[model samples]
Target: MRATVIGAGLAGCEAAWQLAERGVSVTLCEMKPKKYSPAHSYEGFAELICSNSLKASRLESAAGLLKHEMELLGSLLVRVAKENAVEAGGALAVDRKGFSDGVTREILGHPLITVVYDEITEIPEGEVVIATGPLTSDSFAQQIKKLCSSEYLSFYDAAAPIVSFESIDRERVFFAARYGRGDDDYINCPMDKAEYEAFHEALVSAESAPLHEFDQQLKVYEGCMPVEVLAKRGQDAIRYGPLKPVGLTDPRTGRRPWAVVQLRKENRAGTLYNLVGFQTNLKFPEQKRVFSMIPGLEHADFQRYGVMHRNTFLDSPRLLEQDMSLKKDSHIYFAGQITGTEGYMESAAGGILAGINLARKLRGQAPLILPADTMTGALVGYITDETVKDFQPMGSNMGILPPLSERVRDKKKRYGMLAQRAMDSLKAYLQEQGL
Candidate 1:
């Protein structure tokens, strides 16, 4: 049977790839080229709208464990991302264009996949999976609103800005990753206590863009909190967050600075840099005026300014099954950010599971409800858990996983044991299912 996957974003692409790989025909639909969202520009699939870095690659980290699970499930995007990786210390950073282009090429060339360039206003008949991403078109969003009540969706998220590497005050910025993971890969903008207080004053006092009455009190996703909102929490909150000076000694002072603004490489060329954890909804001029107060960004030229946008997602705990399918309709499923799974890799992980479960269903086999011990299973389980009264998008974190049969005290050893147990369960499931 043929299945339809909406949107060529990360989740949709993986969902399409999995179905196609398992001998099921898929029609992959994308609204790009003909039309583009405020955040999207490239005509390629699986576009990276935010930072190019996919976070830390260590198995102990949550993102690292998710990628491990995805690779085991044969995720097309994960493989391609690693192939186009750029140096970001231990993070799986990729060249955004290459990553998107590689995915587009794969989808267009796949024998069982047919690429359809059109905006789907109405849900298609037969089997379908909606992975419209955070910026779902208003028309399709209304349809989803009708399916799942308006109260079940949310529309608040913001992204950080990117600055030209040449625009930075290099003399004021030192290169180093936190705790010196691999090598000096991050360009950290050091600040003294005096500098930080002055910057904080400017940031909190800066003018933000006006929001709609409906959006004025928006529920910003916890994972992508706006820098301004975070700043308002407390003076030291930001210092503890994005500006925390934890792991490196500045070459100039031979001591860790009071605070630091880290700029991560946005691409392999290193021409662009992401203001790590600086997501904001400040006006463009205000962003320039305030953010430039940083020691290394005095005359920074912004390629992309920090802007807030609406990100609509369903309350999946009440709507989706463990496999990410709609509880009310077995033939319909949800994946990606739309399914309330946060982060780039987390969304892709949802796509993989949804695709696998859908394939199993097509083959007359029971959908695999992964054990809670695994990261992927914990994440999926959390989103699909009906007991969660107030549903929110969740990223793959070790906290969500069930406690081990026995506790191991040391931090690294504890995480290592958890990872080992998860992999063991995943391998056993794969062998038993021949997937």
Candidate 2:
């Protein structure tokens, strides 16, 4: 049986690859070049719309553990990311264009996978997985609503801005990553106490763009909030949050700056840089005016200004099965950000699970159920279990996994035990599948 995967974003690409690897003929549909999402520009699969970094790379951190798991599962995205990775201290970052182009080439070159470059206005009949991501188009989204009911979708997300390297005042912006962990990979704009205070006041008082009627109905993902929302909390909120300068010290001063705003390299050429945590919905003009006030961005040229877009999701607890298959339709599965699983890594994990299950069904085999001890399995269980109320999109966190069989008082020790248990279960599962 042929497997159809909708929306060739990160999850879709991963899902299609997994299916193809398992000897399943796959159809991968992407609405790009012909159509583009608000945040997406390149005509490529698994596009990195915002920051290039995929969070931390340490095994102790939840995101790091997820990456490790994906590697063990032979994830295409994770493999390519490692090949094209750029230095970003303890985080796994990549050359955005290289990463996407590599994924596109791999998928398109796959003999068993057929590439379709047009909008899917309606849900196609047959075995299918919807990995459309956060920026799914209106017509297709409406069709999904008709199939799954209106209550299972959402809209309104925000992205950070990108800046041209030529415009930055390099002398003022020191090169360093937080905690001096990685080599000099980040461009940091140091601020004095007075400068930080002034910037904070300006940000809080800055006029924000009026949300469209449709955008007003959507809720912002807590993990990816607009800078304006953060500023509204208080004058010092940003200083403590994105603008915090704890780990960084100015080379000239040999002391930590009062506050710092970091810009990370977005491309292999290092021509473009993205504001590390400056996701915002400020008006374009205001962004120019306010962002220019940074110590090193006095004449910064924006490659892409931060903008707000809608992100839709289902109340997963009420809608999806443990394998990311929809309850109403066994043949139809959902993965990625749309399933209320946040972050690039989390979305990819969902794709892996859905693809495995789809392949199993095609083989006339029972579904592959992931053990709950692992972060991957816990995420699937969290979304599919009916007991959860007020379901929100979640990233892989230690909190989602079950506690250790024996209680450990130290947080680090407890997390280490959890990670160990997860890996043990995943290893056994892989061996059982002959992977």
Candidate 3:
């Protein structure tokens, strides 16, 4: 059987790879090298547009548990990310270029997978998966709305700015990761207590771009809030949130900084570095005016100023089935952030499930149902449960998983048990399928 997968971002690439591995013919459609999304620039498949870090890798964390499950399933993205990993302490961070290149090579090299470079304006007939990510194109987005016939399906998002490394004042900055971890992986801009207080005040008072009428009605996702919005909650909100500097002690001062702004290397060449968690919606002039106040960034040149964009998602609780198949049309499936599953790994998990179900449907076999104990199964259940109200997009968190048979008071021990249960359930499922 043949499958069509749209948007060669993280989830789409994973779905295509899974289908090809199952001996199914696949067409991977990516609209790049011709057009670009507001946040994406590369023409490559599985581009890591934001931070390269895939969050924590220890089994105690929810993202870590999801990664463990994906690894067990022989996920191509996970494999490549591990091979291209950069030092990030306990987090699974990768060399972004290497990771993207690896995925692009593997998909193009697969004999069963054919990649088409044009943007798909309409949903094609037959088996299909829409994995177009948060920054889906305007034309395709319209097509999706027409297909679903639903309004009020958006979750607005934004991106952080990238700055040229050469433009930064080296004398004012020090090279170090938090707590001296990761060995010079981050550039630290130290802020004295007074300096931080002044910056905090300016950030809160800075003028933001005027929101459009439609933009005003849209809700912002918690994971990607604009810096100014974070500041408005309180004078110290940003200092406690993104700009907090608790780990490192400054060599020059022999004291921990009042606050620190970090810039992470964006490419192997180190020509550009992105503001670590500084996604913002400040007007361009305001971005320069407010951001330049950082001690080291006074003369910094911005390669890309942060901008906000529209993010649309189906109310998955009302639209999708347990296997991520659309209830209205069995042949159609949805994956990625648009399905109300947040984070790269969670989206990839949805893609894997969707691809497997599509393959099963084509083979006239019974659809696979994952046990609720597994992280994969839990995420699918969360999206498909009609009873869930205020169905916002979510990352894999322990709160979504079923509670243990016997409750444990310690948080770490509880997470460990959850991970163990999930793995055991998954192994049994795999054995049953003889996979």
Candidate 4:
């Protein structure tokens, strides 16, 4: 049997690899060299277009648990990410160029997989998986719009600005996590009440970059809200959101400051740090002017300014099944950010499920629907749950997973048990399937 997988992104590559590995001939379609999306540049498959970090790697964390589940399902991108990893404290950060090149090599070298470098303006006949990412081309996006009856949904994602670590005033900053949860994996810039007030006012008053016609309709997701838009909600709105000072104390003042700005390590060298939860669309000059108000960032050199972009997703709850196949069309399946699963690994996991399920279908095997206790299952469950109201893209979080049968009190121990249960369940399924 043959499969056509469009868009050789992280999701597309994962889907194509999984199918090809299962003795299926596959065509991995990509438009990188022939045409590029606004967010893409590299002429390779599975490019990391956003932040290089794949989030925290501890099993007790939501992202880490999801990744563990993906590994059990044989995810190609996650495996390659670890191979090209660089330290970002507790998170898995990869050398972007190297990771992309590695994924491209494997996908191209596969005997069953054929790389097709062309733009697909319309969905093809026969078994197909559309893993095209949020930045899908306008022509194909129109086709998707027609197929889904104009329910092609959207949300805005804004990236945080990166600043040079050397430019920061170390004397004014301290290294510590909130209540020292893990090792000192973050750089904290403290703010007094007076300083916070000044910063808050400047932020809400800052000028923003103009949006494109498509982006003008973008509704900001709470998870990635622009700092300026968040600040204007109220005077202390940002204080409770990104800049909250809870569980942290300023060594300089020997007490918790009114608020704080965190800079997370952007790469292994620690030369760059991204402004944590500081997504914004301010003009480049405005970002420099306003963000410099923080004590430690007085001379901060911004490596990249935050910018807003449009992300297109489907109303999956009403359109897709647990196996990620469209309910109305058995031969068509969907995956990635376009299917309403957010984050890098979350999208890749969807691809894994789609590819595996498609292969199983061709072999006349039953569909694999994961239980809600697992992170991967819970995310898929959420996107495909028909009872959901006003569906929105969801990233893996501990809250989504079903509660353990035996309630454990300590947050860390409880999460650890939850992670173990998911692993055990998925392992049992794999073993039963003789996989």
Query: Highest TM-score among the candidates is held by which one?
Result: 4
Q: What's the residue-level lDDT of 304 in candidate 4?
A: 61
- How many residue pairs clash in each candidate at the backbone level? 0, 6, 0, 0
lDDT of 2 at 16: 96
C-alpha RMSD by candidate, in order: 12.5, 13.4, 13.8, 11.2
Candidate 3 ranges beyond 4 A from true positions: 155-309
TM-score of each: 0.68, 0.67, 0.68, 0.69
The alpha-carbon deviation from the true structure for residue 274 of candidate 3, after best TM-score superposition, in angstroms, is 31
Model 3 per-residue lDDT at 170: 90
lDDT of 3 by residue, 293-411 (tens): 99889988775677676666888888888878888888999988889777888888888888888888888877777887788887888778776544556567665566677867676
Q: What are the runs in model 1 whose C-alpha is more than 4 Å off?
A: 157-309
Which candidate number has the best lDDT? 4
Give a tens-digit lDDT track for model 4, residues 1-435.
999999998889999998999999998899879999877888988888758999989988889998988988888898899999997999999999999999999998999999889999989999999999888898898898889886667456787887767668999999999997998988999998899999999999999998865567767778889999989999999999899999998876789999999988754445457889898999989999999999899988675677777878898988998999998898999989899788888889999999999999999999888877788988898788775554556677765666667766576897799888888988887788888
Which stretches in model 4 have alpha-carbon errors above 4 Å?
154-309
Please report, as a residue range, the 10-residue window in candidate 2 with the lowest summed lDDT.
385-394
After superposing all C-alphas onto the true structure, candidate 2 shows an RMSD in angstroms of 13.4
Superposed on all Cα atoms, model 1 deviates from the true structure by an RMSD in Å of 12.5
Question: What order do candidates take by lDDT, descending?
Answer: 4, 1, 2, 3
